[model samples]
Target: MAEHPAYPVGLRLTGRRVVVLGGGQVAQRRLPALIAAGADIILVSPEVTPSVQAMADAGEITWHQRPYEEGDLADAWYALIATGDTEANTRASAEAERNRVWCVRSDDADEATAWTPATGHSEGVTVAVLTTDARGRDPRHTAAIRDAVVEGLRDGTLVAPHHRTRTPGVALVGGGPGDPDLITVRGRRLLAEADVVIADRLGPRDLLAELPPHVEVIDAAKIPYGRFMAQEAINNALIEHAKQGKSVVRLKGGDPYVFGRGMEELQALAEVGIPCTVVPGISSSISVPSAAGIPVTHRGVAHEFTVVSGHVAPDDERSLVDWPALARLTGTLVILMGVDKIGKIAEALVAHGKPADTPVALVQEGTTAAQRRVDATLATVAETVRTEDVKPPAVIVIGEVVKVGPTATAPRE
Candidate 1:
């Protein structure tokens, strides 16, 4: 395949309608980057996987659950044929041409619109190394090695562009609510000096811009509500990035410790040759609530606070958080990802002991300008959420915390 001389052009997938044609782990691996690139993606497959389902549910992607049909390609701007079934992908490719939609054949060697290049970026500068791959080598393996090699070359060419890596202390920086500038001054300073930045997707574009252009940004695999790439992979990525004689910043949104899986990664690093340290952050767990003017800890209405994940599996074989305990527990109860199970959670709390009228507020896309909140009670928060169009990336606050301010002050539940 001849490389388009303009191939390296920075491609912004923003607002384009993209169709992904697979639903398995491979499809999962391909989804986030496209979503991260801001493409409006729709997955077309008979059997959709959980990650894809969640993205669809969160309204991040449009999920077509039925089997692929001929006309599915009609209005797409670009299409990605990722169905493991090569025949389906091939057929989709053909359909793409018929509809005049630009498409990438996930399986074929020479038939498609754009080949996904090995990608890496710093600040707003994006770099992609296109593989001529004429020998028909495995593109995935080749891309991985190419990315690593590029990093080695980048290390030597960089100076002040990467001073962030040479910083003396770890900055437990909050990447910010959304806009990169919302990040604390301390966070920016640390990011500026971070020799090694281990970032999740939560880190914003501007925060990343603080890094040297050559800095190696490891792309970690995200498995929603499920296990992430083994902690070993993340630990090794950070340790290796640092051992290459660079400083490291283990970055997470809100706070590293707040359900951010910071402890697990830190332990892995500590077990290996690397030592561990922490920089505390402004936890969105509470800050997002405050932004909505609904305090998690109020003066008279609320005091104690308990944070729990809506998705985390019980650690003990015999867990103790039955509805009775939850209902009776004092202070505030903050639940993450409890949206799907909001009904069950509320039901349990009420049935066990809590009042059905207990106030509950569900906040999503928290702190960003797009934030939405649904306020209700132990009995109706879920129903309220269903009717209100609340989405994921949300946090839930139950108990008297809902009454922190004048009822009129915060966005209504």
Candidate 2:
């Protein structure tokens, strides 16, 4: 059994100058979290994404448009080094120590001064597991066992936001690709014990059915590519729910942190002295591809996979997608929310480098009985989907694996 983090050092990072040395989605994901924790964040990265620039422009954070400088760590209470580049992250972690500031290395948790546990929170209690250990599963064995246990709990117990606090926890549950059953068992248990469930409107409803008849279910669901929920509003709700001394389960579709605005909520909960933990769910970005018999990473056919939302922005002006290069790439491309952009996305792929006959499949409601896969190609996918009336909440996968029909059952070994 892994030893629990003794004394569980929970530091208050509020109002502290925290320098984050990477400003892409990883940092964007981390920034809202730190800000919610009340950190006066200074983001330093040579390159920044539109999200980072927007956050910087909004005065939600301070931006330093250069690589990490030795002086950047000065006076900073804490430092997070999450640059996707491994070398830069290592150097930043080292630099933070030279400045005598506490540091957390985002790329390598074990290398940090304090490793952030994969958390499960509700009520007032946060269960930080270095890794959940149900006795004996050595390393690799342990991880699988922990995941199984966690998944089982999500699907079975973590649904209700109950009045319990002593064993308080929050399930950062992945509602699972719009399919309720895809949610893990541990997620269900957390829901069952919830006193408040702050959920995305698009998350699966069947999963919510697991909650006891009277459990409080709060719908914080955001409309698709529409009037996005003000982050502050959702933040306030999480704190308010947890402050009620009730277990709040943020039942989001897919993994809460994976494009689910979960980090924002967690930071808010942390600021108010309410512990926050996450229960991860399968991201449809890849899950949908898998359910449709597409291996995101197939040996020679495709070695890399990129998942970008086709709905990051409704109009095409500021969206930064290199359709030309993406079309020619020999890797799987999975897109979410491109029902409207399906025609354009497919055309772009064909116009660039993909074969007109390249296999494309649209898997809707993956991992559930209602799951449906519509197979086509770069040339015909758009029209095929349109004619079939496939709707949003569908994941589009383009790769050779689609031709394999991965949905077929495997023969017993």
TM-score of each: 0.53, 0.56
The model with the greatest lDDT is 2
Name the regions of candidate 1 deviating beyond 4 angstroms: 1-182, 222-229, 313-323, 406-413
Candidate 2 residue runs with Cα over 4 Å from true position = 1-170, 222-230, 313-315, 406-413
How many backbone clashes does every candidate have? 12, 43
Give the Å shift of residue 108 in candidate 2: 47
Tens-digit lDDT track for model 2 on 152-237? 45455433333643655455677777766676656766666677787786677876666677677777754222355577777777
Q: How accurate is candidate 2 locally (lDDT)?
A: 0.72
RMSD of each: 19.5, 15.0
